[model samples]
Target: MARNLDIALLRTFATVADQGSMTRASDILHLTQGAISQQIARLEALVGTALLLRHPRGLRLTPAGERFLGRIRPLIITNDEIWSEIERGDVSGPVRLGLPFDLVDSCFAASLKSYCEAFPKVELTLVCAASPDLLDMVGRGHLDLAVIERAVDSEGGEVLAIDRLVWVGARAGQAHKRSPLPISLVGETCVFRPAVSEALAEEKLASRMVFETGGLDATRIIVKMDLAISAWLASTVPADFDIISEDAGLPPLPSFAITLHRANGARGAIFDELARQLRNAMARPRLAA
Candidate 1:
């Protein structure tokens, strides 16, 4: 006599909302597109309201969908955690984590601390490096999981968030206004370097690399001192810096793909829990904005 919510349908709906497309959700869930649609429809019928709105570009969550997701996401996460703990049976093992150098001080710092506290018996090894290097480590089985940034449209891993790359400079810095814009960069292999260079070249703006380092801290110091302008994700930029825009005569930088790369054959409730926490870490509201 009373309708009951289905976990399967709720999962499908949540995946669609998180991914912004039923197609992507289907891929993640290993379900056919038609099946995904049917699940959504069934869920809607159970709730007696439409949960998704179709748009020309993709899908958007309706008002009801937003409310439903906010309430259910935590429940789903807690449920998963409970299962993981039960299946893990003491959950003691080594987990090698690879992260990009830029994210060390970001929200992930807190996430990592929380994870360590949650699984004190598990040995966690962290290696911070450039994205490409991190990806290689994960692929080679040297790391259990990694968070890397790639071109927005580039495909490969599970995307946690889409980040906007923007030109950054010190507050009140005129370094960007110079005829030959002074720039500082992280490393030769840094993903943002090529994009920044290409964008400047397209705008016919001459630029000089005044400083280059293999570390983010060095780059931060240079940019913070108003020595040079640099490009970084809007989310990762320090609060002390200012984001330069088109108004500053800089070409728009491309969006970046923030993704989770996991080693093959790495399955288990522990690994699943780690991935879930990593997703939560990277999906911070400020980062995704």
Candidate 2:
């Protein structure tokens, strides 16, 4: 008879490898450091070799440990995915989720659709706005949880994707050729507004804000019509849009973190599960890259 590997032990090892610290892995797995150490030891004993080594930095995986983790990582991911699907029906509740307008179509369509289908009883409330507005809405009790984009170094929130900000123009758009640089603005409180302005100022590029709109559709129409150029997270750019190339003399934009924030005192299975879906969705692209 063949010996079976312990999936739980493998999972612990994988998590510790990703986090680089036994203490950090414990926090994520909700196990004490002693428990984490013991589990690692048990796994090493079963494998008949030391798998982890401690250096000044953190836990470094031995060659054997690296090979083990690589082999079992796929198994761990698939196991979790299967469990998520099976448990979906058991999860049903209202979950208020906020997102920037740009993310709804490009990144989250599949994940949100899966969520709605799996948790049929979940009353999902989706609010679309600028990142700052989403945070404000959550604070004012208008929302339960929000996925907001922030400067990469900003504190707080669970960072989902560290997204690249880029200048976007309509395909074959003449807006970039316009003198004084016709820049388009989204919402009044757009978080990217300042970033865009600062980038242009640093480059000493002459620019003018042309059309202002609270509606995303209207802004897209203006942009698609080749009237004004805009900025968007690289991942969220529309299929018909073009990222204004560096040769166009456009200043390089800063990267931002796609972050998740739950309301203060927020605690429930629904909140957690919904947030899990968001995390899973955002992690896919990053993992692929």
Candidate 3:
């Protein structure tokens, strides 16, 4: 009889597919490129087909490989969901989580601390990235749970909290309103981008991006320079930037729905517990930006 494919191989394949590159996948899996390659080769041999196309930039799944991936991903996730359910009483072992950077500073940090204290035996792992990246990670079962901005909606995660998104910058006296209106932005997947674009359009303002970065630190510095403005969670305001009122001819910005997702099934109970804690935290009366 042919040997069954190992879970490790499935995990390696999923990581490579998500990253689109063996090198990057290796970095994430904490395995050598050769090891990742070996796992893929074994999987391909067992399945008797080419699973990935080697390219200078990254790997792309063949049609068959893509189909195979689609079928297998749910299996992996379901397995975790089952395990999580059984382990609820135990709630032990490592729990890997993904989170957006802005949220780390805003509220999740405290939540994480509480979770650790409550489940002292459960090891915690964290992955910090943008909302889109966090969503993708959670969907693949690489993360047990993720706190992402509102945009990443799919079958895997559940909504945790709802919050408004808004634009902010220096007060009129301090605002420079530079020509071309220097604008700063995170990557395209940032939930705030569309809101910012719409707000500018409503005001009939044409702005050019002077700085675009993945890091929020750069956003803070650029906006502080008074040469640019950006959109962020209303709760993420740093105290220096003043919220630009919607009636000030700026388009109405959308609110964000914070979502929590875990692999479906028994393993999802921890996510439920964590989600409960998070919603309770947000319910308290708080200042908006």
Model number with the top TM-score: 1
> Model 3, 176: alpha-carbon shift in Å?
6.7
lDDT of 3 by residue, 95-185 (tens): 7778787777677667578767766777778888888788787768788777777743332344445577777786562343455566677
Model 3, residue 134: C-alpha shift (Å): 1.3
Candidate 2 total steric clashes: 0
> Please, what are the lDDT tens digits per residue for candidate 1 over residues 189-238?
78888889889889898989988864888998999899899988888888
Candidate 1 wrong stretches, greater than 4 Å = 1-4, 21-23, 30-35, 53-71, 81-89, 287-289
- Provide TM-scores for the models: 0.87, 0.78, 0.61
Candidate 1 global TM-score: 0.87
- How much does each candidate deviate from the true structure in C-alpha RMSD? 2.8, 4.5, 13.1
lDDT by residue (160-247, candidate 2, tens digit) is 6678999888998889888899988787788899899999999899999887675677778889999999988898888788888989
- Name the lDDT of candidate 3: 0.70
Ranking by TM-score: 1, 2, 3
lDDT of 3 at 146: 74
